[model samples]
Structure formats: structure tokens, C-alpha cells
Target: MDLRVLEYFLMAAEEGSITHASELLHVSQPTVSRQLIELEKELGKTLFTRTHKNVSLTQEGLLFRETAREILALYQKAMRENTGAETLAGDIYLGMGETGSVVFLMEQIAVFRERHPGVHFHLISENADRICEDIEKGLLDVGFIMRKANPLTFEILEMGLRETWGLLVPEGHPLENATSVTGKQLRREKLILPENSFFQSELLRYLGAGAQERVGATYNLIYNAFPLAKASRELIVCLGYPGERQGGLIFIPFANGKDAYASLIWKKRPVQNPALAAFLEHIGHTVSE
Candidate 1:
């Protein structure tokens, strides 16, 4: 049906007379009456009973009135939300430090998609250190990294949030029974350390010089770490706790070392695009939870 006809029908229903509806709609009474007739024909039912003092809707007309109002309201809301109304609706570029963390990002991104279906997401993944650097270079709108960064250019949403880093032991390992493995316990087993010198250096600092020398450190990815850890009963791997893992690997807390949580980074500058900022905020809230 024509939108003009629907408007005419609504106005006539509201004003209780075609003459008033014509005045309100800036149309002739005959024009208003014609549109109402067209609307009634399209709907296959009479909408109103006209009297000299009042106009009353039929039961079907009353129900159709509610439906029309709801449809118009939803259409208007979509138009407002999709346009520049301080609501986020556009593309967002998000980078993840760890591939394992993508699962969490995907869940949050899914909600964002539902709320703003028009928006597009461009996602990338890399090492934690690289993510921080990208966040510094202004290439990424937001990022999640394993290490803490204090870059002046980018604002941190999740600083010092890495609440725990733990030892990753393959399932069925004996040390799984222990509450927390100490440096002394580490000395007795083969160890899988991070491939990055920065993480290795930090682990050494956390372990002290003497104990650090005994454990074997590898500059390999976590996927490799799983196999190496599983091959040897005594080989223990270190990783951020609650990290992504295959079914074979079991993560346990370490006696030493503070949290190895990933931090969130976004542009420090005033956000030019509300959509991107909203997405960044959503991601921040998700990580916090």
C-alpha cells in the first residue's frame, strides 16, 4: 500500500473526521477519503465507522493500527541508528595478540554484529608484542596483547589486567596433581619457555639466575609447545593462564610469576568515529569479564 494512504488513514483515525485529517495533512477531503478507501481496499476491511461527532475503529482496524505504529517505529529507529545519530554503525579494525584469544573476540564481535548489522569487522592476529607496536603506529583501532604497554600514543583499556600466567602441562602429567609448581619443581623437569627473549628474560627474572639456567627455553609457538610438553613427562611449558588450548593440554597455576594477562589498547586521541569507539569499549568490557 502507498505510504501516503497509510498516513491519511492514521490521521483520519486520530482526528475523528476526514475534514480535520485533510487539514492536518494539507490535502483535500476528497483526497483523504480516496486514500482511506484505497487503504481499506488493500487491507480487505473497513477501518473506521464515521459519525457526526466521533469516528470509531473496527476491531480489525484497531489491531492494524497497533501493527502499523510498531512497524513505523521500528523503521524510524533503524533509520536513526544506521545514520549519524551518535550510534555506532561502520567498519572496525581489531587486532589480536594471540590466536587463542580470537574465540573471545569472535563472541563479542558477534554481539556487535547483531546490534549493528551494517558494520563490518576487519580482524588480524599476530604476536603480543607486534600488536602493541601496531597500536602505537596507529594502524589498529584496538588490540589485545599479552604484555603490558605504556605507549604515550595509545590509551590502554586493560593495563596490568593479565591476572595469571601458568604452567601448561599435557594431560596425564604427574605435576598436574600439584597445586602450584615452584622453581625447585621446575628444576627437576624439562621446561618449555616462550620463544621471545622478552618473555624469556622476564621468566628468568621471576625465577632468579640459578633456577633459570636449569630449565630449557624454546622460541617456538604455543602449538609447538603442546607437542614438546606432551612428548616428555617431565617437560613443563609456561603460558598465560586461561589461554586457548587443545584438549590434550592442561594449564595449572605457577607458584611464582604474577598474572600473564593480555592488555587492551586503543587510540588515545579523541575518537573520530563513534562506531569504532563503541566496538573498542565493547571489547574492553568483554575482556574485563
Candidate 2:
């Protein structure tokens, strides 16, 4: 339960050896072992599987590792924001889905950093749903999402950028040479699509009845699905950006398809963090100009 013990546990997990962890921590080997043992007892779970030479996480340890990281990150963020009271210095955690609008956001960040050099930015790339969840949990200060934000829970800033939806076709595939594809045409092909339920519903509505039957797989991120798409010769239904060129793959737009608009969102709450406040102000000014 102690943060120090959590640190010791993480160190041992990373190094896979108690001696190595102790060496890194500048603590005695037995001290590190004791702390880990105490941690396991406190949690009432065996965290690590021991071997003669190395250690590895048990199934429970694997899950708890994620929780431990989040706890530490939140603690670190709080400490940074509270300590630097005299200076405009703190961390701004931002989550974003993969989109070309990120280019615009990065440009704004560059400008913001130039004005407040002491402030730091942490960028996390994830799907829109995950990003929104983190913002709601106070883990992320802001997020760039490809879907509309619920006005009841979030303040939204439209980026004025729209991404076209399309299919990623492998070379020599039947649809590779097509200029544009239709939903009716897509229904005939085995498709890989985005994993978000809201997005899936929209696509399914466009594809009409029985379209769900043709879905081969769903992916949280598009890049991870590219290999499977190529090997299986399945079309990937994804957002298309300008100047996008993938070797051995072709991006063909959906004829008359609805575009995905980008939006920057944050939880509707009083601005407490100075860095986040400045960032929101800068974004508002940038958008207005």
C-alpha cells in the first residue's frame, strides 16, 4: 500500500531480479525483497512468480501494474503542479486519437510552450472513447476526439477539420483500382472496421442491412490492423487524411460518405490547473483568430 513499496515492486518487475532492483534503488537486496513481500501480503495476492535467476509477474501482477502506474502518474502530476507555485510551470496531460488535426494541435502546443517554457506536455495516443474516459477521470486535461462530445459532460471546440472515411485495399486486390467505393459495394467485401460502437453504428447504418455479417475484424487503432488487413486481403474501413500514402496499400474514398469531424474536448469543470487554463485560453484565441 505504501508508495515506496510500489516503487520497489515496479523496480523488481522491470529488472526481473531482486539484486538488480536493489542495485538500482541503492537499497539493500533484502530490503527490496522484504518490501515486495510486504506488498504482496498487504494486497493478499501473489504478485510475482520467482525463479532461480529471474522473476515475472503473475496474472494479478500484470493487472495491478497498470493500476500502480496510473497512481504514480497522478501523484507525480499533483506534486509538479503544487510545488511550482511562483512559476507558470506544471504538466498538461493531453490525449488524442490518431488524426491529421494533431498537426494543428502540436503547432498550438509549440507556441504555448514558447510562452511558458517551464510548462510540460504529456501526449497520450488512444481511441476517442479511451481519451474521453481519461479526461473524465481527471487523468487527462484535454483530448482531441473524432466524435462529437456530449455537451452535458464536456466543453467542445470544433477544429474545423474533417476526415473522409475510406477503405484501405491491398495491392492487386479487386477494389484497389477503384476511384471511390459505395456502402453497397463494401457489403460484398470482407471488412475490418474501427472498434468504437458509436462509429460502428454509423457505418452499419450507411451500409444498410446484413453489412455487419461481412465484418471480418475490428481494431482499436488503424495502424495495428494494417498487417492483418494486407494478409487477409480484407478492406479496412478507416478515416483518410490528405497526402496519405501507404506502400502496398491503396486508400479509396467512400462515395458520398459522411466525414468525421475533429473536436477538442475537456470535462465541464472549474479550471483549477494554471497550465490547463492557459492551454484552453490559447486554443480559444487560436480558434477565434
Candidate 3:
């Protein structure tokens, strides 16, 4: 429950040894061990599995690790923002999905940071669903998602960019030279597709009936799926970005594809941080111009 104890728990988890964690924390080994014991008691869960040699996280500890990290990050952010109230400076956390439209967002961030040098940016790359969740949780100040903004929950700014859905085929494959591929043609090949449920549904709709049978694997990020696609005959269904090329792979658009639009979204609440407010205003002016 204590922040210091959380730090000790994380250090022990990372080092796998109470001795090593105490050495790093500038405390005695017994102190680290005692704190961990108290932490486990407070939570009523055994967090670590102990051995004579080292310690490892139990299933509960593994889940708690993520919660601890989020707690620490949020605390640090609050401290920074509150302390820097007199200055237009603090961290602005942003989440984004993989999309070419992020180039426009980065441009705005560059201009904003130039005017407020003390302000910093932290960017997280994730799927739209995860990004939305983070924004809702106050872990992110803004999110660039590949979907329409939910007016009820978020204040939105249209990025005015659309991503083309396409196939990432291995070089020298039969479809490499094709200008565009259709759903019927795709049904003949095993395909690697995005793991996001929203996008998966859209893709399935685009591919028509019985197209799910052709799926070979799913990927959270397209780059990770590239090698899987190259090594085998599997085609990767992903968004095509401008001037982006992968070695040993060819990207061909889907015939009459449904393009995914990009939107900048934040929680529909009062903007308490001046840095975030200024950044949003900058984006509005830039987008309008």
C-alpha cells in the first residue's frame, strides 16, 4: 500500500533477489524482505515464490506488477504537473495506434514543444481499444485512434487522414504484381490480420461470407507479422502508409477497400493541465489552417 514498499517490491521482482534489491535501494537485505512480507500481508496474497537462490512472481504478483507500474506512473505525472503549475511545462502522455496519420500529430507536437521547451511528450503505441481505455483511465492525455470518435465519452479532433487497407505479400509472390486484390482472391490464401476486434469485424465484413476460415494468425502490430508473412505464403492484411516499404514484401491495396479514418480523442472532461490544453489548442489551429 505504501509507495516505498511498492518500489521495494518492484525492485525485488526485477532483480529476483532480496539481497540485490536491497543493494540497489541502499537498504539492508532484511529490510527489503520485511517490507515484502508486510506488502503480502496487506494484500492478503502471496506475491512472490521464494527459493534459496532467488524469487519469482506468483500469478497474483504478475498481475499486480502492471497495476504497480500504473500507480507509480500516475503519481509521478501528478507530481510533475502540480509542481509545474506556474510554468507551461510538464509531461503530456499520448497514445496512438499504428497509422500514417501520426505524422500529422507529430508535426503539431514539434511546433508546440518548440514554443514550450520545458514541456515533454510520452507516446504509447497500442491498438485503438487499449488507447481508448488508457485515455479513459487518465493515463494518457490524448489518443490517436483508427476509428470515429465516441461523442458521449470523448472530445474529438479529426486528423483528416485515412489509411488504405491492403495486403502485405512476400516479394516475388504471384499477387506481387497485382494492382489490387479482392475478397474472393484473398479467400484462396492464408492471411495474417489485425487482432483488434473492431478492425477484425470491419475486415470480415469487407471480405464477405466465410472469409474467417482463411485466417492463419493474428498480430497486434503489423511489423511483427512481416516475418511470418515473408517466411510463409501467408499474406498480411494491414493499413498501407505512404512511403513505407518493407524489404522482401509488397503492399497491394484491396479493391474498393474501406479506409480507416484517424481521429485525435481525449476524455470529455475539463482540461486541468495547461500544457495539455495548449497542445490541444495548437492541434486545433494547425488542423484548421
lDDT of each: 0.66, 0.82, 0.82
For 1-289, candidate 2 gives per-residue lDDT tens digits of 7788888887898799999999999999999998898888989999999998899988788767656755665565577668864456667789987666788899999999998998899999888888888777656778998899799999999888789888788988887778888888876788898888888999988877888998989998778888998799998888885336564678888888669998989878543466777788998888888
* Residues 100-217, model 1: lDDT tens digits: 4455667878998888787788787666666666655544567876766677766776543444556777767776666676666665566677665667777767665475666664
Model 2 scores a C-alpha lDDT of: 0.82
- Model 2 misplaced stretches (Cα beyond 4 Å): 1-86
Q: Give the range of the ten consecutive residues with the poorest summed lDDT in model 1.
A: 236-245
Against the true structure, candidate 2 reaches a TM-score of 0.70
Instruction: Count residue pairs with overlapping backbones in model 3.
Output: 0
TM per candidate comes to: 0.58, 0.70, 0.71
What local lDDT does model 3 show for residue 16?
Answer: 94
Listed per model in order, the count of residue pairs whose N, CA or C atoms clash below 3 Å is 5, 0, 0
Ten-residue region with minimum lDDT total, candidate 2: 240-249
What lDDT is reached at residue 177 by model 1? 64
